[model samples]
Target: MSYVSSVFQRIKVRNANEPEFLQAVEEVFKSLEPVLEKHPEYISANILERITEPERQIIFRVSWVDDQGVLQINRGFRIQFNGALGPYKGGLRFHPSVYIGIIKFLGFEQIFKNALTGLPIGSGKGGSDFDPKGKSDGEVMRFCQSFMTELYRHIGPDVDVPAGDIGVGGREIGYLYGQYRRIKGVFENGVLTGKGLSYGGSLVRTQATGYGLIYFVDEMLKHNNKVLQGKTVVISGSGNVAIYACQKATALGAKVIAMSDSNGYIYDENGIDLPLVRQLKEVERKRIRSYLNFHPEAQYIEGCKNIWSIKCDIALPCATQNDISLENAKTLVANGVIAVGEGANMPCTNEAINYFLENKILLAPAKAANAGGVATSALEMSQNSMRYYWTFEEIETKLKNIMVTIHSNAAAASSEYGFGYNLVAGANIAGFKKVADAMMAQGNY
Candidate 1:
């Protein structure tokens, strides 16, 4: 084991509260065990421990008035993990599922994900427990303004930047940015991302995660002597990532037959209707099962995991962590699933990941495969800094190029490290080397 790993094992035993954070860190280190052992300098610099811990964690209370004039309070957090490359960069999630553990896990993953983008952006994550799902527009706005009331004090154009995640979307960003501007009294456009097009949002930011996933999968298919020209695809999650993934995959000539949500999924043999689905999801804010009402040909299943068992040539798990298990991995492989690209953080558990690796299935970890979202966020920051916005074509072209470079770099790192086509190893080693070298150059902080 590497000396840094040895040090981490000791710290992990003493810090039991940070299980999610530790798990995220462990996965990255597991693939880099050999590299760390071969390079003692990284251990001497304690890069492992430093990378595991955040540079700062801000936990505060978000108190706001509801539409009924009642006061509601929730916890908010911003875990600025690392800034070796640039300012802290990541999304701010607003869901009932959010907490310190979830934020820490996401923030830790952001460190390497941002690094993979080859951009000068660092890693950070923040959010609150205020659920916007059932709340009214006025209620949502009040809560977002309160969340930003405290969050704005910590973030700036060149400091920690937050974007949209889960319940935090264009509407939430609008409210948050409004409050930040109201308080700061300046149009700090870059401090928050996923903004409306009228403001500073990039053209393709909404589609980056899904499009990037396909781009990485396209590269993987090329390596396997295949293509997405007419492949059957199954995607999990009906949120921004999964919906856009379906859109991009369909646009690229693939037939996406199935998609899932937190409740269940729908399978359409005639290929999912992207326009209809987007209308239902983005405009209507409805569930996947509701798609059947408009299209009687579609079938809705109650359980979400059933989507994984559906036969497909490509499987993209664009949902939450550990959503894909060992059994699901085996099922996909047995069903001739050639590739699996993660669009979520740690979507596959370690066992599930090892199953894909052992079976020689082409796999792209979330950090590398889904770096497009944050990379585009960094692009938004650039536009904000320069006081100019990029055209739709310009932003999309940049996102595609970044995803392609990330795929190639990860492949090259895997080949150089004797793992050949093992992208997990490649992504970990390549990202680690950049951060590790930076840490080494800066000396112990």
Candidate 2:
């Protein structure tokens, strides 16, 4: 434990201002103590030190013209954290909150998330501090073009592959992929995972994360001698992940009663209308409050956090990081939340996570729980490489198998490490072993 604590102390000193990054390192490092105790070679080889550092970091200026013919500037980053297992693979988030700490934290978490999928992808993440919310189509395209102009040099089909996240969706991916094609002048469809279907995109890529989450939760419930059917669910975030999770949970016989956006949440005692949610958030791009216009019986609250207070059999935090604070954790526990599957990266705070684990609440950590998006992206990469397409049923089957396997591996790891069903440690440890072995076999750089 001294070595782990010492390495973390140095990380704290070196990355003093990078709290997000430090939190990521601390979380994984805590899980690694048992691994280190069992395998002394890992400690002697300084794997912890090297694994924590990114393989490459790129920050560039993105300048584009706005609708008013004004010059806009934004900062972009691509942290190629590691590529030992395979090419660097992760998402590019476009939001005002993106910074080095956020990108690094996400990239570090991506290492384990990708590994837990039992895929060949390494880990990386990219994004810009640009708010693309109100931007016109032309403006968004210009921004994406500008962002890709510099990013293209560092990525390729067998290199770093960036997918969509947060503010970057099909619209953003299409723009980015178009820009990459324009600059490269080649059909490197494998370079990007979230492309349009006509251009080597997978069928279920959009719904993969959300659907995969439910599948993983199903496995977990089955393992625990329970069933997802007849369960009441509450999910935060009305984005792609949340909407799809709600849809999948409903399809699997669970009633998703509440869902939220940043502005507020909607509670429908009779279970949420998934089609209506998709219409409002996806097609119409309206807020969750707009749900009330369609169904007057449903309640709409003003804040996103209060959605956790509603009693539910399960909670899925599909929103942003640290969304479930200690207070929210207490509320969920009090209201009898039996399990929580994180559909977002680091959705729960450390304190909140500790509370859940200590209370013996079934918890699915984000890295393991929300890895479906990237896993399906890797599948898309395989399809692109083979110049073939898979049917929706075929892809869904693959995704289900992968999720079930991930749950099995994580549970086994937790049991082996004396953590029982503590999936947080299990996922981190399982993922770390794969990448650590790869790093060791490849030798130090």
Candidate 3:
């Protein structure tokens, strides 16, 4: 068997129950065959094996009191996967679906995604099984305090820095940072990235991921002699990523017709109202179905998956992992989706990705496409370290340049390996080679 296959087989056996992690490992390993062939020393040195396993995995029980004064227990996890280039850097997700396997998968993906940013950050991911939905401010704050009470010890400014993911956002970050400050008794702004603006948060950080996804997609279209103007875009999820993707895509002249939440989706044939979406999701924290109250002319779908069936020129899966299955891919292709840019990690399943590739749909993989969040997080880290801040224009300009460069790097790697714009393999190879080289140079830890 080839070295890539051998390493994957071992990972499969060891992580048999961790289907998500195994899937992530398999996806990354499939593109690494060429690298393994080029550098035999990597296999001999067991770099792949070492990189597959995390440096530390912390699982602890978080007990906090809800508004009812009853003690509730939730399991929290932190997977400090790799720190070869610099300190461990990633996000913390808080949701009911969070588990060790999920955390491991996210952390594993982060290793490559962070490398693709061309930054000096490593990979890590953490989260809890506690669902933040419907939780009061006091309850959420208490839970965050409990979560940070344990996480603060394992992280530092120059050590492991975490931002926000699915369930964790600006509010959660503030609570976690506040707790960390209270516990440490020192002001360490660099310990976290998604802080409030008054307390050293970076501008454009909230819109970074969504804006970056569109920027990368714009680059992809440019490569094909196309542009975002007049394109009908359908984006899944109405959270930070989806909302901002809609905002940016609209500013770029695309008509975003649909966006969703866990409950359902809203379709506005005249183009989604970005302000109303921001109000419903960010301010009111209401379901997407509520969008109909304002835009009565728009259609509301009862199921989120059916949002894929809506015909559009572009599809951005900004929701959760494995949302686009084989059937969904078939529906999208049948409806003539010209391009797909994943705003969420591993949103497309392996079968779905194969269908898209076979149908010749232009795809921007998550690592390269949705890397704007972490890339901006890294920029935030730089500003925090210097005790300085950049204006929105300055930060956004840097972000655009970075996204363009990432596209070029991925395209170059694909062409070099004869993939010819196969960004999946391109991003994997490009990201893995950097981490592999760094690992080799550092020797065994």
- The residue pairs found clashing in candidate 2 are none
Q: Rank the candidates by lDDT, best first.
A: 3, 2, 1
lDDT of 1: 0.88
TM-score of each: 0.97, 0.99, 0.99
RMSD of each: 1.3, 0.8, 0.8
Q: In model 1, which runs have C-alpha deviations exceeding 4 angstroms?
A: 1-5
lDDT of 2: 0.93
Model 1, span 39-117: residue lDDT tens? 8787777788888778999999999888788999899999998989889999998888888988989988888899999
What is the clash count for each candidate, in the order shown? 0, 0, 0
TM-score result, candidate 1: 0.97
Q: Where does candidate 2 stray beyond 4 Å?
A: none
lDDT of 3 by residue, 1-445 (tens): 8777877899899899999999888888878777777788988889888989999999999999999899999999999999998999999999999999999999999999999999999999999999999999999999999999999999998899999999999999999999999999999999999899999899999999999999999999999999999999999998999999999999999999999998788889999999999998899999988989998999998989889999999999999999899999999999999999999999999889989989999999999999999999999999999999999999999999999999999999888877888999899989988998999999888
Candidate 3 runs further than 4 Å off = none
Per-candidate local distance difference test: 0.88, 0.93, 0.93
Comparing candidate 1 with candidate 2, which one achieves the higher TM-score? 2
Give lDDT tens digits, candidate 2, residues 1-445. 4989999998889889888889888888878778899999999889998998999999999999999999999999999998989999999999999999999999999999999999899999999999988788899999999999999999998889999999999999999999999999998899998888988899999999999999988888888898999999999999989989999999889999999998999999998988999998888888889999989999999999999999999999999999999999999999999999999999999989999999988898999999999999999999999999999999999999999999999999989988888899999999999999999999889
